[model samples]
Target: MRWSKPLSALALATMLAGCESIFGSGDEEPITRLPRALTQSEQELIVASNRFGFNLLREVSARDTSSNIFLSPLSASMALGMTMNGASGETFSAMRSTLGFGTMEPAAINAAYRSLIDLLLGLDRNVDMRLANSIWVDQQFPLHPAFVESSLQHFDARVTALDFGNPASVKTINAWVDQGTNGKIKTILEQIDPEIVMYLINAVYFKGSWTQEFDPARTSPAPFHRADGSQHPVQMMFMRDAEVRSVMNDQVQMVDLAYGRGAFSMTLVLPPNAQPLRQWAAGVTDEKWQGWIAQLHDGKLDVSLPRFRLEYDEVLNNTLKAMGMATAFDDVAADFSGMSPRGADLFIAEVKQKTFIEVNEKGTEAAAATSVGTGVTSAPPTFRADRPFLAAIRERHSGTILFVGLIGDPRSP
Candidate 1:
């Protein structure tokens, strides 16, 4: 998510005159190259984020044939949602009325979602980025009795291991996933618990474009050797380029690239001669990623990639605590009295997230990206991520960490 695009000082107040042409073609015609319109929801942002992560994993996931798959501890960890059911004790009529989109106005739902967006996108100037998450399941979640009852009790949400062949449920959940993922992913929580009350979810998915877009013509069925020296024919996107960047400390040769639609990008770092990926990933930090990216000087390069897919599950209750959202997710410390009369008692029960993604040449192969921020260096309308690198979905205003993660591999881990 690059924000270096320049905006002309030709203030819109004067530029909007009938005589002035806001469009870049100079014919007053609208510019077709403009980016897509900013959309809604933090989880929607996650769908975008997953797409990007899926893309990068293609190149980096194969680092160790024995155990080179990448699953974000952070990705599998941080999640937030509030669901209420069977309110019998406290007076939650006002809040309960908002059950299942029937009680709450779209404006209210959008407002709550926007509150998260403001915080998640608060940072953009820094380049450290991997995956981000924020999701709200008000309309899609089933109409639980808790929404209309009093003194709501608990909440929970789960992404299915496999899709349940249902019509309405599939349609609703898939719709959100489709829009959030820009058609890259079609089903997110296909196995949603119909009995649950409410779901407020958010996530960030990202991956850069391929330095070398896999030419369908060259992709061949080859045996991707495993560390155990075992081999099986796997459909791999293969290319050979000579100009990739090299690092000395890790003896890793790497480069960067972007996925289709220019939505997200990634940089790949491989051991000089196939070093163990496990050892390399163990020491990863936000700062080291920045340093590597800072050293990338554009040069001719050759690259190879593979086709991949993956699904990740996380128990985010703990990671959120590590990140400072403990009080909110904690039942004992929570102060959601504004949301329920039970006060500390009416706190988050469990936040579980299951996110899936696939990477290929066809535009994120199911991707999602979301950000908001106003930085000293307004993000460039364009940034090409064709190597091993770090990226973030900054709000552009607040520069917050809405969602972040790594995609060492998109294959099921």
Candidate 2:
């Protein structure tokens, strides 16, 4: 009963920036108007998406406690959101619940994503951010018109039909990824599997200069203690008596480093010296995260951060299955009839993601690409990052988390 033709979905995120002016000097105003108000459903969707991100992080970190982990939850959700259009019955319910969609109807989920994407793209003018989706189909596969129409209308995805049998199609698809991420990520596929009848992809790119740029002249080599009791020399950038939003308690020290008129920011969470980064992260629930964010306040402190870069790649089939979406990957019990008449035979074979990030005296540049084969399947602050810590890039107004990661060792790329 296993279907030979599988569906693949991919998502990517990239961030790029450089040195810029200081934020919150006490007199500056936001350059752009505030983003529009969100509907109740939109607001609910945002909460659900963030919860899903936290859950995913917990699952990924638990699997490997001493490695750098980076991912784009928004990108993965959007890609799967597009694919969800074709799911029905138990398969559909499993995905909706796994994504924290709760009782929201499928149409509501699609509408929320459409509105959210528009709002994110228009929020900060000084920052360059883009979200794009695409659906690539085998030339001969029969896709339901309604499924195609819904993806186009709700996800704003580009639809392309090509000969999956042609090797050149890989280049064509990767070209779109390169363009979407502004060349930060050039490829998402080495070769499309013949059994994969369609590929759904989402790409995100963000570039924003720090409101307060670090002075490269002040950078010095410092020791970064690893979680394993080892230490290595790292290029630690220092900013003394800088005005930024920060909070601290017995468990962790967190700070918000703003970008582009304070709309987008990178939040860094540093666990106490006695606590392992993984142990601290394991206790973070959605409520705990929200509480910590609410406690951030403007303050003056000395800050030291390491200039580090990391690249992470992982197959997420097991992670998603662990999150309660196992039915979608089950060959016999899965259902995707909403996508096409061949729904009974379609199952996700695999899901994969590759990510890259670099932070230095100037700014941050990050890129991530996630591939779901139907087969398928931060901050800152005074606080020095001289040890393992956590980071998240987010939009302040809507509380939308674009990226999140854990840095166990800065010396390892």
Candidate 3:
């Protein structure tokens, strides 16, 4: 969410036939569209999710107003949605309310997510977008079978049981995250805590080339003013004369830049002259956002945008708590019995996200990964056989005993 300096010129660009010099002239490709219309549930879910995303952004921005903030609300929602399947009682209610799910049942919510994922992945042939999910459980933890089944059926999440004590397990999980985000994000966890029993992860990746690319020759060094009144030189990309859709008012100017068959686009919002972007963004609501989007009309406008890249990482525990989800973080009050028979001991320990984004002459490339970790309130008792002990091998499902032995002295093998 790096803010570029306000454009020096906001007037319409001159109509010139020199398209070959300013924009690329390529054969038009067939537009790819959604396979089917969105179901009512899917549409509702998307609207609610957008509101949640906006709220989450405001909350995160309130922490440090000047810093660049970028996060994938989709990644966070999907990861939390998966975890929500394992919640029960007040924890479930709080999470559902915080996510803006309202009265939607769990089954309907999961179905909507599944349909939405399919629609997004198939929307545009030229755009590359992928979503992936996974669940990691400690070997000794007894997770509920129903939770595993639902995650696989609804979210297509990969489930694995790992030896959390082994340091190699950290590498294994990080490798999956690396692959999921196409290497934009390499690791989500530095180490697994001893009290942690499970982790739910989601990753999203997107790369799209602009419908009309900005010519590199037009890019020049320009002074970019910072919110702190500091000025720095930046590589500013210029579109001299392009038919761009835009909307403007006294407070801000908004422009839409389409990407690949117009299935997706990037909207650039610039605040009024001498006004800090954070000030304007803090007041942006869902209704205001929708109004701005609806007012966009086609026009020939000259655009000056700076190329930038950003990477951000943050722990969302406090953020979610402030958003009315405190019960989920409480070890004693949290109820996730749907996850395990011993759910009373389980609580959400952490919610973390890492994100990367780069916008250049071609288009935008972004990737993000979010992880939710659950930990036990107290350590489970450990059994140590310092004296004689009995050992047996048995089949769990059928309750068939295979072998038994009594060990007195290890030296007398």
Q: In candidate 1, residue 151 scores what lDDT? A: 16
Each model's TM-score? 0.49, 0.93, 0.83
lDDT per residue, candidate 1, 1-413, as tens digits?
31111100000000000011111221232212323333444434333233323332332333323232333322322222232221222222322231212243333444444444343333221111223332232332222333322212111123222222344654764565455444444454444443332333323443333323556677555554444455545455544443333333444454544322222244455533444444455455434545655665544544444455554444334533343344444334444343223332434444444444455543232233221000003321222122222223222222122223343332311
Q: For candidate 2, what is the lDDT?
A: 0.80
TM-score of 3: 0.83
Better of 2 and 3 by TM-score: 2
Ranking of all candidate structures by their TM-score, best first: 2, 3, 1
Name the Cα RMSD for model 2: 4.2
Which 10 consecutive residues of model 2 have the lowest summed lDDT? Answer: 17-26
Of candidates 2 and 1, the better by TM-score = 2
Candidate 3: Cα lDDT at 17: 11
Candidate 2 lDDT over 293-376, as tens digits, reads: 999888887888888877676667788899999989888887889987887778887676667677877676655555555642
Which regions in candidate 2 have their CA more than 4 angstroms from the true location?
Answer: 2-4, 16-28, 31-33, 375-382
Stretches > 4 Å off in candidate 3: 1-33, 377-413
* lDDT scores in order: 0.34, 0.80, 0.65
